[model samples]
Target: MCAEPGHYKPLDAPVGPEPVAMVPVVQLYARDVPGLAFPAGTDLLQILWCPLVHEDDQYAANPRLLWRSTELTAAGTAAGEPPRPHTVEEDYLPRPCTVSPTAAVEYPNGDLPEELADLLDERFDDLKEKQGYCYFEVATTQQSKVGGYPGWTQPPDWPHCAGCGTRMEHLLSVTATEPGMGRWLPLDDRDPRQGISAAPSWQAEADPAALDTFGHDMCLGDLGGMYFFVCRACPGTPYTHRYDC
Candidate 1:
């Protein structure tokens, strides 16, 4: 399972070697090809060569024809180092990792309280079809919303936690969910009280001390793609009124 949480699992495999980081496919264009397939176990500095072949030929036109090895030629093995072998294992599926929901916490699910399970099912269908991957999208009604200051919204400096007075730096990871799960979770580590507000006034109501203070009352929606959670330690804010509306 790729790390994160609240994800859906299709099949289980004994943990193998740590997964290899793939080159981002978004950078590739249709007309272009990867300089060479960086097969498993290939070193970074190795020079790979691609072999050219004719569509059909019983025998080589020239006796001196050479077949290329997928492994990088320049990649050298130190003393007692085994030569890296090239293997083309194309069985791995590409999907975004899933973030698991907080265990044992009750979600305020209204119409379908068990919707989270259903969301996982939908994600599985998408993965089977290879449609696309899902990341955390803020729900319209999650209790606490994540926040960040403009221009520097990359966490630590941006998304601050009011409870521990700490910036959410570490990702308490979860499992990889199936594609299209649509199970965006609340960023509970950041906020567990479920009192995040989109408006400054709502925040003021949540924390009346902020009424005369300089802090801004930001909501989770402002932080693009972040799921917010409320802090239990500092339940200073009242239950947000906007959740029911």
Candidate 2:
């Protein structure tokens, strides 16, 4: 079977349970991705990943999120290129494209369990208009490339910190596609003939699967995403990571 222009057919060979090289996919400063309240003194947000498969339940590759203090790490010099992995799943790699993070309101997945939605109806509807879509739909903003607040599905329960048992705050999401890139293509990108294209040689050479993972990571055929949360109260505590389809 033929693959889509920017997508790759899954390989017949077996893939991973080990770590592959990691590369930086996107980096967002607190200013770039709005609405997020980062812990004081740590404002840089980076999303990096190993293109190869990992031992994840929903997806093979687990992307990593790091919060850093730019003042301490800044080297007053141009940044070097990110290193490439030795091997990767063609379907789990991402293309090299610039990110323009825009703020957007998001909604819960329309198919969430009725019982769960019923329980939060008052809270969800607080910002929702009587005649419009539910609060989860119209009032939430899906920021950056990460799929914010898990639309089309109920969000995973709030995670708790292992150390303090305090509920963590939603930091950000790392997603396969930028928010609203599909349903609302930009004016310059509106041509239907302008279909997906292959990744450039530099990206493809770094990892052949680069084109396949364009915009978002592929998780078991569904474009899956990862969520990161940090405990604001406990500054030194470990953060939490969650995977969702």
Candidate 3:
């Protein structure tokens, strides 16, 4: 009687179509800073979900429902909170003066292209032969959309001091004499090319040709061992010097 005879089949006849699991969806984004939420890592995908009955606009308002991955969530994304692990990998961009697959790569400025790197390598050797060691300042002539370079500008009087938060005029300048030496250093951690050294190396002499080209006065004996490698327009003024360091 409780089974209702032939009409009442098994209580789990169709097996309830198996419980559907809530599959986790992940999304990624290229953020200015790290941990910005993105929808599916730039590669889009479609997802099905049950909308709340109270939702006024269903498809139009919440057409694409995105889920965030733990890696991209800021303090777990419950509300407006700064993201965790705020270190984003740098994207390398190409420069107009350099030969690259594209016009630019999204990374720190001064990242020289392969072709330009080769030029610097040659210049480095050339400078080393004449001077004790070679130095260079890899930079772009273009103005940044975000304003001011990582620090300085190519033009002298163009307010290098303001945006960079330092008086660029006071900063010392260095240029790569070696061809390709200024390009991205090898991934080899053991190599000195991995990063720039803070202190200037006294391994080479100054190139007279570079002096003539840059036009800065060649004080071969500025401090006995300290000679300046500057341009004609950048003298007497102090600059926030940046080089391989």
Clashes of each: 23, 15, 50
Over the stretch 200-228, how does candidate 3's per-residue lDDT look in tens digits?
A: 32222233353233311212111001101
Whole-structure CA lDDT of model 1: 0.24
Cα miss at 98, model 1 (Å)?
22
Which one wins by lDDT: 1 or 3?
Answer: 3
Model 2 scores a TM of: 0.61
Identify the leading candidate in terms of TM-score. Answer: 2
Error of 2 at 137 (Å): 6.5
**What TM-score goes with each of the models?**
0.15, 0.61, 0.17
Q: RMSD in angstroms, candidate 2?
A: 10.3
Per-candidate RMSD, Å? 24.2, 10.3, 24.8
lDDT of 2: 0.52
- lDDT (Cα, tens digit) per residue for candidate 2, span 4-60: 122212463543343356667667787766666666688787767666545544445
Q: Which candidate tops lDDT? A: 2
